[model samples]
Every structure is written in C-alpha cells, then in structure tokens.
Target: MLFRVITLFDEKKNKIPATIVHGATIEIIWTSIPALILLIVAIPSFALLYSMDEVIDPIITLKVIGSQWYWSYEYSDNLEFSDEPLIFDSYMVQEDDLAIGQFRLLEVDNRVVVPTNSHIRVLITASDVLHSWAIPSLGIKLDACPGRLNQTSMFIKREGVFYGQCSEICGVNHGFMPIVVEAVSLEDYLTWLKNKINFDFNI
Candidate 1:
C-alpha cells in the first residue's frame, strides 16, 4: 500500500494535491507507527540496562586496577591471612614466552579466575590513565577512570577462557594490555584460590 502510494505520487506531474499531502490519516500513521515501534524496542532495551545494573548477593568481589600498560586484580572478599587483600598484576605474555597453540598478544601471565555459575562483582578503577576493562564474549565493557571506581556484575555460565583487551587508548603500550578471564568449575576455582592465597601462585 505504501509503495503504491509512493508510485502514484512519483507519477504525478506537478502540484501534489493538498488532500493527499496534508491527510490526517497519513500524518497519524507515520507518527504513530514509528512511536509504537520505538516503544516496543525501548521495553527490552530498558530491561537489559536494569538487569545489567542490578546488584545481586555476590559470592565473590574482585577489584580491578588499570595502569598504563597492565592490569592488577585483587580478591578482597575472602582475605583471611592479613588485612591486605590478595593482589596480582596480569601482564601480557611476550611472544617468546608463548607456548604451543597459544594466541599472540592474547595470553597473559595471570588470568582473572572466577567460578562458573557464581555471581561476581567487579570494581574497576584506574591508577594512572583512563582505560576500559572489556570482554566481548561476556558483554562487559567498563571504564577505568583515575580516582573513581566503577562497578559491574558478571555471572559466568560456562567454563572457558574469555579474552579481551583495553578498549580505551591510554598510551603507546595500550594494545599490549590484554584481558583474560578463566572461568572454571566451583571446585577447581576454590582449589586455585587456595593456592593463590597460600602459595601466591599465579594461576
């Protein structure tokens, strides 16, 4: 119907009739249809935003500090040894240090480990410059601004290694800083966490 109307208008010689030009039905259809479509789209869009911002009772909370060319992670929830939290710096593995079948510029010396099927809260901040802690597969992209803490939540549903990089351009070595998240089963994660807290193992 719309195509035929457009065809009829295109075939007209000159002086388009005011009845069709200023038709109330046409005006209402154009305005109301787009408004209705937008309303439909906005429903799910707002729902996603609210879901992303919703804070659940997380089992573990991880603090991420972004520096010029590296990322530091802290497991502060279950710190029992001392008042200080368990902290580690995750650096990009150099090309020469990479093992067989390892991805170049994607592997890190340490990976941020979290248990599958657990609600995890991540607090992100920058020590020096602005950076973005992003993971494409998990749909997380958070800004790391100096002196300010940004919070986000994640619930890992599967066990795998998800890779990401700094989305913000902080410095010349910004590309060198990559993010790696290793999601494992709850038992394996607890074992790894025990080793991390006890032996200071970089797992």
Candidate 2:
C-alpha cells in the first residue's frame, strides 16, 4: 500500500506535458481519477475494520513511556512481577554493532515481543518531553505527549522484527530513540516473557 501511495506521488510529480491544451479537462481528470481510486480502496479498508471489530477476546495491552534518551515498555495485561511490573528500557544500538538490513539509528537493544495474530493495544505517553511512536510495517504512528496519552492498535500478521524511531524532535538524544517490535509465536512469546520477568540484575 505504501508503495502505491509513494508511486502515486512520483507519478504526480512527473505527469503530463506542460502544454496545456485544456486546463478544465486536465483539472477534471486529475481530480476525478484520485477520487475514484480512493472509493475503490476505501471499501476494502472499511470492511476489514468492521471484521476486526467482531473479535471476541482482548489479546494484549502495553504501555510505552518516552523519555529523554530511551523508551520503556510494560506489559500491563501480563503480570511478571509482584511489586514491580514487567518492564524494560530500549536503547539504540551503536553503529559498530549494527547488522545488515537493519536501519542505523533505528535498531534497539531490546525489542518488544508480542504474539502473532494477537490484537495489541499500545498506550503511549512521554515522561518529560514530546515524542512519537511509529512502525512502518504496521502503518501506525502516534504522538507521545508529556501529559496526554495516545492509543493505537496493530496486529502483526507475520513473525519477525520490525523497527521504528522517534518521529518527533524532543531533545539532543531524540535521534537516538528507537523502537523495535518482535512478533513471535505464542509459545515463544511466553518463554521470552518468563526470561524478562526473572532477569537477575545483582552483579
């Protein structure tokens, strides 16, 4: 879908001869074609949304906190700790440790793990400044305000790692904040969650 939209932009930029034979006709054609295409696409989008609304169960819930230099995530629906809830901080990886096919400045140390085919709701808010949370594969981007909460939803269709970054400028470290999401099987997610919950830090 992003490909189509981006291609459309390219087409618009490179379209037609500058010699205007009929301005009125060109306006009508340009306006009507995009509207017609939108109508064609809106039908399926609406239907898919309505179908998802009928799901019977809530799969998972996560809370995200954007800070000056890092991001923190918590699984509110899955309890991992009694006194302290299960949470972790995600930091961007340095250039030397980055791998191929991963976008530099957009890879994190710890990526959030969720089960595939599960409805996941993310609640985003900033701790001290404004930021944005976005994932291109899922087509979701929401603002993270200091005193306000933003919510967005996405269901991972496949199991893999996806990357994103802070879309809004906050401070000196704004470019260092990264978001990584890993969609895995339910069993694998449970195993990872257990490890996260029981991690020892008493070095």
Candidate 3:
C-alpha cells in the first residue's frame, strides 16, 4: 500500500504527472486514510486503557514488598498476626532442590495463593531497591518503587500456577527473584486460609 501510494511512477508510467502531485483529492485520500485508520484503532485502545484503570471493589487485597532478591507478601484482608505470622517471604528454589518437574528458577518457597473468579488487588512496593513484579501469563508488570506504591488487579479465571520474576536490574542477585501465584477454587482457598491463618471468618 505504501509503495503504491508513494511511488507515483510505476512500470506503466515513467514520469509523475504534475496535476496528480498537486491535486487536493490525492492529498485528501492519503491524509484521511491514515487518520481514519488511527481513529478506528483508538476506540478499542482507549476502552482497554480505561478498563485497566477501573477500580472495582475487591474481595481481597494483597501487599507485595520487593527486596534485594526476594519478595514479601502480606494478606491485607487479615491482621490476625499477633504472634503467629500472616506475612511471609518468597525465595527462589535452588537448582539442586528443584523437584523433577519443577522449573529451575521459576519456583518459589511460598506461592501467592488466591481464589479463582474473584477480584484481587495487589499493592506492590520495594524496600531496598527498585524492582518489578511481573507475571507474563496474567499480563501484569507493575514497578515496585521504594517508598511508593503501585497498584494492579487480576482475576484468575481458572485454577493454575502463574510464574514471574523481577524484570528490573536491582542488584547482583536480581536473577534469583522469582514469583509464583497459585489460583484455587473458593472453597479450597477458604480452607487453605483457615489452615494457614487459623482465623475463623464469618462468611
């Protein structure tokens, strides 16, 4: 299309016509075509941008803190940790300790477990240096800036394990920072929460 529109002198025509070059019709056709194409594309792009920025009432909010080479997670829905811990750090699984089918640098000690078919908000921040909490399968990559919070949301449709890593070059052990998120059913998630948190919810 570019060649046809740009190259006025084709195989049949050797020299370009002066009227065709200076005509208003040709200029309008060339200019309006790109403008029309851009208008056609801008509709859906703006819709997606607005939808991503939409803030819905989330059932659970999880806080993620990025460290030098690891991540810390806190379940914001529960503050029942007086002595028993409700927050934990996730460290990457070493190569030797990896199971047969587990990934080499993708697995972590504690996975961020969430319920499927639910709206979950994640607040990401960094403690030591700048980091990025990214999950490829979920299409989420939010920066973990120190002393600042970045928010993102996700709705897992099915039960699966999503993996990610620190995309930013923070320090020497940046390659070791891996993240794992496991989505389960509502009943299973509630059961896991009960067992993990040991707090009875009046749901």
Q: Report the lDDT tens digits of candidate 3 across residue range 92-173.
A: 9999899899999999988999999999999999998999999999999999999998889999999999999999999999
**Model 1 over residues 1-203: C-alpha lDDT tens digits?**
99977877673544665554477888899999999999999999999998877678999999999998999999987665446688999999999999999899999999999999999999999999999999999999999999999999999999999999999999999999999999999889978887877744333
List residue ranges in candidate 1 displaced over 4 A: 1-51, 199-203
lDDT of 1: 0.91
RMSD of 2: 11.9
Q: Ranking under TM-score, best-scoring first?
A: 1, 3, 2
Positional deviation of 29 in candidate 1, in angstroms?
12
User: Which sections of candidate 3 miss by over 4 Å?
Assistant: 1-51, 80-85, 200-203
Best-fitting candidate, scored by TM-score = 1
lDDT of each: 0.91, 0.84, 0.89
Q: Candidate 2 — worst ten consecutive residues by lDDT sum?
A: 194-203
